[model samples]
Structure formats: structure tokens, C-alpha cells
Target: MEPTLPMPAAPSSIHFHANCTPTNYSTSPPNSWPPFPLAPAREISSYLNHSRHLSKSKPLPSLASSSQPRTLCFVAMEKKFVEEAGCCYYGGDVDVDGEGRATALRPAALSRPHTQAFHLAWLSLFACFFAAFAAPPILPALRPALVLSPSDSSAAAVASLAATLVGRLAMGPACDILGPRRASGAASLACALALALAAVFASSPRGFLALRFAAGLSLANFVANQHWMSRIFAPSAVGLANAVAAGWANVGSAAAQVVMPVAYDAVALRLGVPVTVAWRVTYLLPCALLVTTGLAVLAFPYDDLEGNRSAAAAAGGGNRSNTLWAVVRGGVGDYRAWVLGLTYGYCYGVELIMENVAAEFFGRRFRLPMEAAGAAAACFGAMNAAARPAGGVASDEVARRFGMRGRLWALWAVQTAGAALCVLVGRMGAAESPSLAATMAAMVACAAFVQAASGLTFGIVPFVSKRSLGVVSGMTASGGALGAIVTNRLFFSGSRYTVEEAISCTGITSLICTLPVALIYFPRQGGMFCGPSATVDDDDNDDGDVGANDDYMLLK
Candidate 1:
């Protein structure tokens, strides 16, 4: 037989409902019973024992038959404030919300979709970077084979940057239409085709210039790379995700510098192939790498956490051209985007110049062999492995303490310091200069500062306008190309300035560009060294209705 316990008498017309919970009970009147909140089993048992004793001491009369029964129900309160408290190994370090987007960067956990997207994004970009810059390391052999003049070489460099500028601008809207996965993969494949053709047809100055221009379309992958990270990670972690992905991808340029010359020697010397034919054969390797990585990127899933992208596109009027126009129009209208673009031009622009000219400069200035010069330049690109991510980490840490204003201050400070270091690099590069060892040390320091500044620039990008992230990224990225073009035309291409003089001018331009950071402001979080304005609408603030004390939540 079932054991029976002493029961409290119910009030007249009262009925208990089995489907009730604590949430409704807490909000109900005194007569309603409750669903227990989640707690330890022992604590619940103790409370039940006390309730049983109270019922025995204070029994009530039974319900009357003539009165209608009233139903009472309740539910346990939903926990709205659960914090992330899990390990990265088990995928807990990243806070995955209901929709599966991560709130923290857990790069070591690549088995998960978010982290997998991060890997694919960077790897594809790495292939593109390698293929795009591979020509420079072999330029010594290449220039002689093509019988190119210095003017032709510089014009080729400018052409590459110009093509990349246009490509980046177009890629932003393409990402909005097709998703980052498809956009990036397509770009890689297209540029691989260009690279392969360059191997076969780059016999004349015009052909080399055209092929270089076409190959530069590869760098447009940068837009997809940053946009992908921003969408997969939460606002709190987006900056670091962007930095780490791009930083690691940037290492491809360094790898190209080291690998291409070695490959050339192996093909030309060890294999007994003609030097010209060997360089052409070496080009095939990067093309193959690009093709493989691009297809791999396409094989991965598109992490569109929201419903179907096609559905979203349909909802936006089912016209891709209109959507593209709207996205670019809205993105360009933001003054902050323009400011960021100019700033990006100087820092990233200077970095581009270094990647192109570093090997050549070292070879020409110090009379080093091709292998030795390439090694020195590789060090600059290698810093992207840690220095860029360090900048993002610094930005995140400062924003946690001082809000958005803190991030801007950190960006300005580092960029200014980096520009000053660029001037120092010029001083060290004099006609009768210090030892190569000392010059290399200074170059490494300047590279770290410049790359870190690039990282810091993107740290502020996600917060600019979440709705137009791709376009804004494109604008900023294209700015780097434009800055390279102008700098190359004025300082690098002609006989106007020596390489050292050009570098100093580049540094000064970067310093002036850093001034625009003062114009970038978040309504609730304010600008650098300023409080929130009283009259501006904060529609762009993703962390809604944040209090002074709650700014940390946004950073987290």
C-alpha cells in the first residue's frame, strides 16, 4: 500500500494544478502554491520537512461542494544572468548563446563550427597573401628576365595596389550578397587563374603589369576574412578574432619571402633548369596552393546563424544590386568609416610598402645576397603571428576598463609611436649607416609597432555600424591600397626621393592620419577624452541602454 502523509486542509473552492511553476506562483496571490526553484536536494528536503510539520499544526477546513474551484499555477523563473564558466577544451571558454554564436575567442577549439570558420577564413587568406606577394622575392631574377626598368617595376607595384583597391571595394558588397565563404573562395580561384597566367605570359612589361594587376584581386579576401570573424564571434571577442585571423594570414607574405627564393634556387641550380624557366615553374606552386585552399574554403559550412541568407535577401527586396547599393551607400555616409579608412591607409599602407620593398631595399643597401635579404624582410611579416593579436588583446583589455573611449586612445597612442619608429628607421638607413644587425633590430621593432597598429584599427571596426560591417571593412581595406598607391607614386616610383627619404615621408603621413581618430565617437561610450553627448541618438550602440557601471558588460 502507498504510504500516506498528514495533509493540510485546502481553503474552499481551491484547486492545485500539476503544470504550475515558481515563476507564476511568485507573481500570484497568497493562496496559490509554487514550483520550487532549482536548489540542492538536501535543502529542498529540509524545506519540505518544515512544511509538513506546519501543516499538521495548522489544519484548515475542507472545501465546500457548492463553491466553484479556482486553479493556481506557477513556473520556475528563467535564469537570465548565467555567466560563461566552462573550459576551452570542452568548448565552454566561449559563451555560445541560443543561436550558436560565440562570445569569446577559443582558437584552440577548432572542432566546433565557429572555430572552424575562423580557421578556414584565415587559411584561404594565407594562400591568397602568399600568391599575391610571391613575385617580389624572385623579382631580382624576374626583372632581368623581363628586361624591366625601375620605372616599370614601380608602375607594376602601383598597378597591383590599384587593382586591389577596386577589388576590395567590390568584394564588400559581394560578401553581403553571397556570404563570406563563397565570396572568399571565388576570389581565391580567380586570383589563382591570374597567377597561373602570369607564369606563362609575363614576358613583357605590359603583360607583367596586367597579370600583376589581375593577381592583386586575391587580397580582396581580407574583407571576407574580417567580416567572417565579426559574424561568428560576439562583440566582446570580435576584435581579437579579427586580429588573430588576419595576423596569422599576414604571415603568408613572410612565408612567400622565405620560400619563393629557396624554391627558385632548387629548381634553377639543383634541378639544372634555366633560371627563367625555373622562376616560371616556381610560380606554379603558389597557384596550386591557392587552388587547393580555395576549394577547401568552399567545402566548409557557411555559419549563417540566422535563418537562410536567401530568406534575408528576399526580405530585403530580392534584388542583389539594390542591396549592394544600399549597403555601400549607408557605409560610405558614415564619417567615422572615412576616418578609419584614412588611418588604415597609413598604417596598413606602410606595411604593404615594406612587404614589397623590404627584400629589395636590404639587398640593394647592404649588398646582401638574395637569400639573406629575403630572411631579413621575413622577420617583419613574422611579427603578425603575435604582435597584431597583442594589439587586439590590449584594445580589449583597455575597453574593459574605460569603455570605447579607451580603445580609441590605445589605437592613437600605438599608431603614433609606430609612425615615430618609422622615422627612426629612415635615420638608421643612411648611406653610411650602422651594422646590418643593428638596422635589422630597429626594423623588427618598427614592424611590430606598425602591425600592432593595424590590429588596433580593426578593433574599432565592428562597433562602427554592425549592419554595414562588410562595406566598412572594404572601405578600410581599400584605404590601405590607396595609401600604398599615393606613397609609391610620390616617394617610391620616380627619382624624386631615395628609399630612406620615402620611408620618413611615409611615417610623417601616418602620424597625420592618426589625428582623425579624435573624430570617431560612440554616443553612449563617447570619444577619446570626452563624455557622452546629450543630443545624439545611439541607434548604432549594439549594447543597448548601458549604464556607466555596465560598460564592462559590453567589453566582456
Candidate 2:
């Protein structure tokens, strides 16, 4: 007789076959059957009891079948969980995984390639300013060597600045069409070639002036530098990044003031070279540096205006014939861009004018030696290393605290203070016994505020229109140059107005410019003219509504 075995427990979700046949199972009840040979019925009953106890404890699924709906529901739930945990559904490309979130919130240190791009952009801008201001620092040497009278030298200096202004105006459209990498590289190369030619073959003052003017085109690299930084850094950090680039580059002018004279003296004394030849040779180093920087820009992979490796790659048609024209039109149509340009003109333009005239002002006012005055004047440009970056950092903090209003508020505060400082400096200069220390202090304060204002103005530039950033940057920079030119004409005009009067005039102009800045409005947070009605598409969407926000957002 067969032993009576206990039943084993099983999950309801699983089904098992109960057929008993020679090919399938033994001819006995499933719970009672034992495929393996048992010594006696007692052993089979004991085995069945142990199996039933184990099944009751675990209730494991049978090796038979599973529900299709349950399996598919589980799969769908797992997929949904993954997407919720790992995906960004708001059009951002950032992954939402643990590591991805960490990376997005606090990015890793700049990689080598990014670092290289930053350094190259900085060096290129520095070289441009270095070459542009090279002639000014050595103007004393050039005066006699090139047989330039005081008026002639001053006019030539202003001409170089004027040329830079024109270059900046054109650079906007060029940067948009050709892209910053190519535009920067080409401008740098042209500057180097011009400097080299001037150093080697410029015989007369006029010839040298012409070459220097040509070399001043390098100043257009300012636009390229800012554009590069805008692309490389996050929107929140772009203010500081642009300020650092601008500030470091502006240091080139001060460096030239200090280094060029020393280099000339070193070459003349150590090499026993003639003064004329030594002065000319002094340009070779900066020229070589400029050329090398240009080549580096060409070699490196960088983004164009549209954030592409190349302009052709960015555009499907591969034809940028109308790009320049469209950029200009778009830039001009945006009143906010022009207002910012005007604001920049007051701050940066004042800096440019003061940079060129500070030495003369100090020399004439304090009756100091040329060398001492030059050193004192250098203090203005040198302050850039600290002041410019500080401005940018401060602007970022203000934005964080106050949102869009904080940016404009910061701009207004600094410009107003700057205007006051300028007036104070003028008042001190006009006093009977002018205090050189006091005036220098005032000038330094004024420079800091002015440069800070420049940083603040640009902090809002990228928000104006992503597609027209290059054009906007170029136009605002050109405004600085134009301001300088107008100020220079007033200050340097045939001994008509004194330095104090000119300084006062600049202060008055800057104070007035702050009004427009205060009046400017934004439609959305972190956006100037970029609202739903004014959305700009990358594919040349030129509907009448493209810049419609500009009209309503300018003063609301």
C-alpha cells in the first residue's frame, strides 16, 4: 500500500499540472507520489511532510506559469521609476541621476580643454590691448624718433582710438557671421602683421600712425573675448567670467606702460643697439606673441555665435552672406541694446579716455617727471586686474539677491558713485593747491566704479538676445570707443579746455546716462527683450514679432 502524504502549499498566482502518466508523472496523487525510490512508506511520508512544511514557510511560486498582466505592469512601473529618477522633462539636457544632479549643481573644475579656451581668449584680448596701447607708452621715444610734434602725437593717438572704435563697430557683425574663433584669429593676425611692418619699415610719423591705426583693429578682439566667455560659462557665472576676461586684458595696457619702456631700455643698454632701433625692436616680442595667440585660436576647437564648432556647421545653407546684415538690423532694432551701449559708453569710454590722458594730466598738474607721471597713470589701468573682476562678482551677488532688478540697481548705484567721484577729482584738480595724493585717490576710486559699471552693463548683455549677443557686445563696445573719441576731442582740443573742465564734463555726461539705465525694464526674470512674443529661433525666424517685446519692455 502507498503511504498517505500531506499536501504542499503553493502561491495562487502560479498554476501547476496535475496529470499522472508514464511520460509526465507517476500514476498516483501529486501530493502522495514520490519519483525517487524510498526504503519504506515512512520515508516517503516524512519527505512529503518536510516539503509541505517548507512550502508553508516560503510559499514559493511553482515552476508552471505566471500572469502576463502582472509581469507587464511590473515592467511599466520599473520604466516609469527609472525615468522619474534619471530624466529631466523640462527641456533641459541635464540628467537627474544622483551623479548628474551633483555635476549640474556644482560642476567639476574646468577641464584642460576649457582651461585652454579661457587662457587663449584672455591672452588674445590682452595682446590686442597690448598692441593697441603700445605706441602710447613709448610715445616719448616715438616723439623725437618719428619727428612728431605734441599735437601730431596726440592726434595720432586719438586716431588709433578712433580706428579701434570703427573696428569694434564692424567686429559685431563679423563675429556673428564669421564666428568669434575665426574673427578673433583673423583680427589678431592682422594686428601682428601691422605691428611687425610698422616696426620694420615705418619711416615717417604719418606712416607709423597709419600702421598703428591698422594695428588698433586688434581691439575688436574684445567682442570675441566676451562672446567666447559667454558661451563657455553658465549664465549665472558669465558676469564674472566676462569681467575677468576684460579686466585681465585691460591689464595689458598697464603692462605695456610698465614693460615697454623697460624693454626698450634693456635692449638699448644690453645689446648696445641704437635708441631708434631698440624702440622698434621692442615691438617684436608683442608682435610674435600676438601671432602665436592667433594661431592657437585657429587650432583650438571653439564655438561660433550659434555655439557650433564652425559657422558653416551651424547653418544648413553654409552661406552667411546675409548674417552680418541681419545681425546689424536685429541689434539696431532692439532699443535695450542701444541703452546698454550708451551706458557702457559712459563707463568704458571714460576709462579709455582717462587711460590715454591720465599721464598727461598728472604730468601737467603735478609737474612730475615723464617717467613718474607714466607710473602714476599706469595705476589707472592696473586697477583693472582687481576692479573689473570685483564688479562682475558683485553684479552676480546682486542678481542672486534681487533678481533682474538687482542687476539694474547695482548698475545705477555704481554709475552714480562713479559720477560723484569724477566730479570730486575734477574739483580737487581745480583747487589752487591741488593735493596729488588726494587726486590720485579720487582717480582710483573713479576708475573702480567706472570699470564696475562696465561689468554690470555687460552682465545684462547675454540676456538681451542669445542669437544677437555678438552684435550687442560689439555695438556696446563701440559705444565705449565713441565715448572715448568724443571725450578726447574735448580734452585734447588745441589747449582750449583744461583737464579739470574735461573731467567735469565727462562726469556730467555719465550722470545723465544713468537715467536711461534706471528706466530700462525687463519682461521676464533674467531676460531683457526675450519674451514669448519676442522669441528668437536659431533658424533665422524674421517675423515682425521677433523683437516686439523691446517696445513694451523698454520703460515698463
Candidate 3:
């Protein structure tokens, strides 16, 4: 006497199979189908509507026994089907196209999370770069007030790089644990506070150096910035997106070089404020901007649109801490990561060294005024605007034709050319009668190549290991700091060499570092001169634990 529910026939495409066989079909009474428990009414309606659309005239077969088992089986199959075919966000499955990423980038589409994440990532790093480099442009004023010697200035640069190195190492694992959104935002806010303290309390050389070290922690945001882009964008567009974000952020350093000096001039000269007080006040601009953008990063976008780590418990059924340690170990153990780190050291490390010393170099060697020297230095960092993006775009373009090998070739070619240019610029400085115009011209070209090399270096980073993406990013970024520390300590610190001599030595080191690019090879993707293995396994997931739900999300 159990009442049965009438159901339309299932389409040929819908298959319902399970382990349990029905006990009785002919003996089952009419009007006796069991209702599916916990299935929402709207979902059942949707399924019926879909069934009706597939077949209008076919009469549906009755259930054997109005049993709960059969009803549950149908619901399970439906849930699985929706998960595979339907696009989802947050904890659900990602969009299906590019593995949870959009195929194209739309910078102007601020309403979308994909685009919003991109803007927040770059802007946060941009603010951090500004704060970290702000002091270099106004070093003339700072040195006089704080009684800092040339050695102390060099030590300050070393201190900052060392702090940044530690921070980068820690942030990589933190990004994997807490997500890039929290990791980057917290670092930015902390560095902003340090900048504020430096502006107010840094009256002596030691205090200035300590605060500079603290502020340098902001640069650790670079690891998260790259990690965020890699997670959000598809492999096809990831290179350009990473390059564009980092390149735009780097312009902040150039902006600091120019803006701080101009702001100092406006306050000290026009307003008749003391030079010391004007420089102190100038620090507030970057400090406030850092706080603003840091909060924006935390507030706006989803932690990761694909939620790769959201279901950490289910991936291999391992504990979260064990997984984290595994990823760190995997990233650290990889020889290729070390090679990329060394190569990154020369390109990005040289860029950092330039940001700290270029203004001083121009002022002392060329006899330019403070503002003019800062402006010239700004030119070097400014090349990042286009030069870096060109490197990334070139990597993506060549990659389409040549796979991973093409990316390696592009990086080697561009980086080698950049190293040669660095040597040329140093020789120009060593000229008996250095022509300012000609030197500036050569420096501009050198900047273009050097910045492009940075872009090209990252172009290969993402492919190294998807599972330890953040850790690899951190290792690579920290290497840049280590390179700066070594190069600065050896050539520039304690008046070990003339500025021109240091520049030449640094260029030579860069050339030596570029040789390692040949050693990096991917098993499935091939290498600089090798082809992929003939029996390649497409299901290889050796790098990291990518969630099944972490697929592409196409933006409308």
C-alpha cells in the first residue's frame, strides 16, 4: 500500500549503476516508490525538467520496490554529474576550460574576481616596493642627518637584503598554509608600520639600518605575488600575467626614486622646511599607500579562485602539517629550483643593487645634483614597465612553438645579452673621459635588457613544480637577495672597489650565472635541447597536490 511516485524515463546519456541489485521487480506493488531523502525539491525538479527535454514520448519505468537504496543511487550519480559538468567556485569544482583559470586576461574588468586578484596582487607589491626603496633617493639628506658613512650605507643595503631573504623563505610555506591573500597583506602592513617608525625614530645610523631591514620584509610579498598569479591564471597566460604584475610593481621602486626627491624638494625648498624634516615627512606617503593597498588585498579577492588547498584533508588522506613539510622538502630537494634561484640571483639581484646605489653612483661619478641623480636612477627601474612584459610575452609566444625548451632558449639569449650590456655600461663608467650622454644612453639599453631578463627568469619558474609553487617562488626570490648580499659585500662594501669596478664585477658574475640555464629539464615537457620522452605519462603529479576541484574558471 506504499504510494509510488511516477518518474519520466532517463535519457541514454544518464547511466545509473551500483553494487546492489534489486530484490524484487514484479512482486513490488504499484504506487510504492520511496522518496529520496535530503535531495532538495528544486534539484529534483531540475533533473525531471532535463529528462523531459531529452525524451518526451517514452514512458518511464517504475521502481522495483520503493526502496531508499535505489533513490540514493540516483541522487549520487546526479551530484557527480553536476560536479563534473557545472562550473563552481570557492569549495566547489573550478571552471573546466583551462583548469580553473580564464583563457584571456581583462585588466579593465574590475568586477570579476580573476581580474580583481590580479590588480590586488600587483598593487600590494607596488606599494611595498615604494616603501622599501624610498630611502635611497633621499640618501643625501639621510646621510647628513644620521651621520652615516659609505660603509654604513652599504651595510644598510646588506641588512635589508638579508631580512628580505629570511622573509621570502618563510612566506613561501606560509602562502601554501594560510593562502597568499593573508600572507601578503600581513607582510605589507608590518612593513608599512616599519616605514612609519623609520620616519619618526631613525635619527642614528643603527636605527636607520634596523628600520630599513624591517621595511625590506615587504619585498617578500613578491613570492606571494607570483604564487597568486600562478594559481589564478592558466598555464597559457600565466607567464605574461606574472611578468606584467611584477613589472608594474617594480616601477614603484623607480617611482620612489623620483617621487621622494621631488617631494623632498617641494617641502625643503618651496616650503622652507628643514631638509631632515622634509625627508622624514616624505616617508609618510609610501607608508600610507602600503597600508591602503595591503588592506585591499585582504578584503577584495577570493583566497584562491580554485581553492587548491581547501580540501587538504582529502588529498592522499595526509595531515596538513605533513603535506606542508612535504612540499617544502620537495621544493628544496629539486636541483632545478636551485639553478633557477642562482640565475634569478644575477638578474633580480643586480636590479636591487642598482636601486640602492644607482643614485649615489650618478651623484658621485657624474657630479649630478641629488634630484638629477635620482632621476637618472629612476630610468633604470622604469624600464620594467615595458621591458619586463616584453620578456614575458616573448616567452609565451616562443613557448607555443617550442615548448619548455623555447622558454629556456629565450631566457638564455635575453639574459646573456643583458649581461654583456651590463659589462658595456661598466666599461663606459671606466672611460677616462666618460661622456654623460653616451653613458646614459648605454645605461637605458642595459636597463631594458636586465629588466627583461627578470621577466624571462620567472617565465620558467611556474613549470618547475606545481605542488611547491610557493616554495619554489620563495627560494628563487630569496636567491636574489643572497646574490645582492654577496655582490654588494664583495665589490661595493667597505670601499672594496670603485663604483665602476663593482659594476664590472657584477656584470661578469651575471655572465657566469647564465650557464646554469642549460641544465634545467622537464621529463614530460623536455629541456633546452631535448625532446619529451616518447612514453610520457600525462597524469604525472609529482610536484604538488592539486585538488580535483581546482580547474579553470572562465570569466564572462
Q: Is candidate 2 or candidate 3 better by TM-score?
A: 3
Residue 384 accuracy (lDDT) in model 1? 91
Tens digit per residue, CA lDDT, model 1, 1-556: 1111222443222223332222122232233333223332122223333443343343333234213322222111111112122101113234543223566788786545577889889999998888778888888888878888888888888888998899999988777667778888989998888878877887888877876787688999999899888777776777788899999999999999999999999999999998768888998888998899899888875534442252125224454544566666767888888998999898889899989899998999999899889989999899999988888888887877887888999999998988998888877897486578887888888889888888888888877765567888999999999999998888887788889889888899899989989989876679986877787543443322122322222555
lDDT of 2 at 306: 21
Q: Count steric clashes of candidate 3.
A: 14
How would you order the candidates by TM-score, starting with the best?
3, 1, 2
Task: Report the error of model 2 at residue 33, Å.
Answer: 53
- What local lDDT does model 2 show for residue 179? 78
Of models 2 and 3, which has the larger lDDT?
Answer: 3
Model 3 is weakest, by summed lDDT over 10 consecutive residues, at 87-96
* Candidate 1: segments with Cα more than 4 A from true spot: 1-93, 307-322, 536-556
Q: Rate the local accuracy (lDDT) of all candidates.
A: 0.74, 0.67, 0.75
* lDDT accuracy of residue 129 in candidate 1: 82
Model 2, range 1-556, lDDT digits (tens) per residue?
2322223442222123323121211122334433321122122223333343343344333224332211100000011111121121111222121111101211233332334556788888898888887777677677777788877777777788788888888887777677788889988998898878878887777867776786678898999888777655555667777888888889988887777777877887888898778888998878977998999998875452122333222322344533555556767778888888888888998888788878778888999766677788888888888888888888777877766677788888898899888878888999999999999999999999999888888777866755567788888888888877787787656778777888888888889887788556654543333333354333433332223322211211
Instruction: Note each model's CA RMSD in angstroms.
Output: 11.4, 17.9, 10.2
Itemize residue pairs with steric clashes in candidate 1. 20-74, 21-74, 21-75, 22-75, 22-76, 23-75
